[model samples]
Target: VTSMHSLLQSATFLPQLGHNPLASGPLVLTKDGHIRGVSGDKAHIFYGIPYADPPVGAYRWKAPRALSPWPGVYDASFPRAACMQACAGPIIEECPQTVSEDCLHLNIFVPLEVNFSTPLLSSLPVLVWIHGGDFIAGSASKPLYDGRFISNFTRTVVVNLEYRLVVIILLSFSAVNKSSDM
Candidate 1:
């Protein structure tokens, strides 16, 4: 079985021949499901793809569960909410106003030249960027993290991912410790 990490790591060269002519964006079929991403001048941008189930309710304070294959084409043209966090200050406009537990999403930027003709083992390198936030704040949806220019200029696939932070991490550790005492 292909691990999710490897699947995403190699997603750069996936065939892009599944475009829906009636849709406004490009379509890419992943193991999880079909996703529609916007087409940019230099890259194809897929945003807010869920890598795992929402870390809410009973799932809270526990490890994230793998996402099952979704039934339909997921609209990945727009960014999703960032994981719950506080804005650093007034000038941090990139901080998303919406925050939720269901924020374990990732964004992918693929160069325009990488098409169906490209082999799955294409020579292009993949860059996986995990945001730095002192374990308290940060989001993959930040405009500064957009990978279009990097993907286009470097001729590579770029991926950015969002993860739980601060309170969530603390709660998780506390839960684990308490459970271990049982």
Candidate 2:
């Protein structure tokens, strides 16, 4: 059994004794737009950054389209909703309560020691994590996949991405079948 203390300690989302991101979040400008993220003791965490436009309406069952540059700073302090999926058994606890079709976002974790303002002398290794749920139910937002611990310990940049899951896949198959029958 995991103790609450240990769970809290392991949680990368919880801010530690260092920088207070609430007062002034760390800002990073990306092609899509500027993002503001939170800073923990060991890592600077950017959460729920959309890589593509929301897959809805005509966009559904199609390849994800590139996102347009947002007019203002995108607040990335909180994790976004998980892709629509049914949660069951013990795995349910690990899943986000809210789910949606517009969930193709990624979280980035950078070691706090790396100064983003200055040019890096050397490039840090990157670790991209795709959550496992047999291509169905897991989410990058799950606390189990939080990358702060790994980023700080290994001095590497970590990224966790969300992808369309079971329902979307099934719908796509159904659409294909229907179109062929037409």
Candidate 3:
């Protein structure tokens, strides 16, 4: 997996890390569909994690759609794909995305101190952040506004979500999805 910067939009970044992350033991990070990385007691931080369909082609500049649920625990060792927008620098294609009719996804920033086995605290709240690239440009997946800061600052969950907020095209998304069937 690779980590890179994203363009095309501005995202709200909320740090989720606590001050004493080093006090914990190592943690696991997942991505795609496998166990990816292990962090030292220093803390395991995953960022720009993708949780949906890529915003490419017909899905470009459109509303976000439902995401494909992952089977195994995702190894969020690295960041996921950022939205597609015009940029003027060395772009990293690591999180390559194709324009398609399916383009709804979310990213997460979770703390290492917490895990499934950990007790659930009703006081904990999750903050889901929506980006403002409008349509055609902008991605919550951008690297700069990622998990490191949040996982180190707060105990809450920070999610960078990508959704469709675009000017309606002449044809509806139904037609777009149909075309892909062929």
The root-mean-square deviation over C-alpha atoms between each candidate and the true structure, in angstroms, is 2.8, 9.1, 9.6
Give the per-residue lDDT digits (tens) of candidate 1, residues 114-175. Answer: 76433545466889988887767888888788899999999888999888989688877888
Candidate 3 achieves a global lDDT of 0.44
- Poorly placed runs, candidate 2 (over 4 Å): 1-23, 180-182
> What residue pairs are clashing in model 2?
none
Question: Which candidate would rank higher by TM-score, 2 or 3?
Answer: 2
Q: How accurate is candidate 2 locally (lDDT)?
A: 0.75
Clashes of each: 0, 0, 25
Off by over 4 Å in 1: 1-3, 88-94, 116-121, 176-181
Error of 1 at 84 (Å): 1.2
RMSD value for candidate 3: 9.6
What digit string (tens of lDDT, one per residue) describes model 3 on residues 37-152?
A: 33423334444345444546666535444344357655545545444444334543432354323434455555555543344454344566666543545566555456546754
Instruction: Report how far off residue 25 is in candidate 2 (Å).
Output: 1.5
Kindly give the stretch of ten consecutive residues in candidate 3 with the minimal lDDT sum. Answer: 1-10
Deviation (Å) of 162 in candidate 3: 2.4
Candidate lDDT scores, in order, read: 0.79, 0.75, 0.44
Give candidate 3's total backbone clashes.
25
lDDT for residue 58 in candidate 3, whole number 0-100: 60
Tell me each candidate's TM-score.
Answer: 0.85, 0.82, 0.48
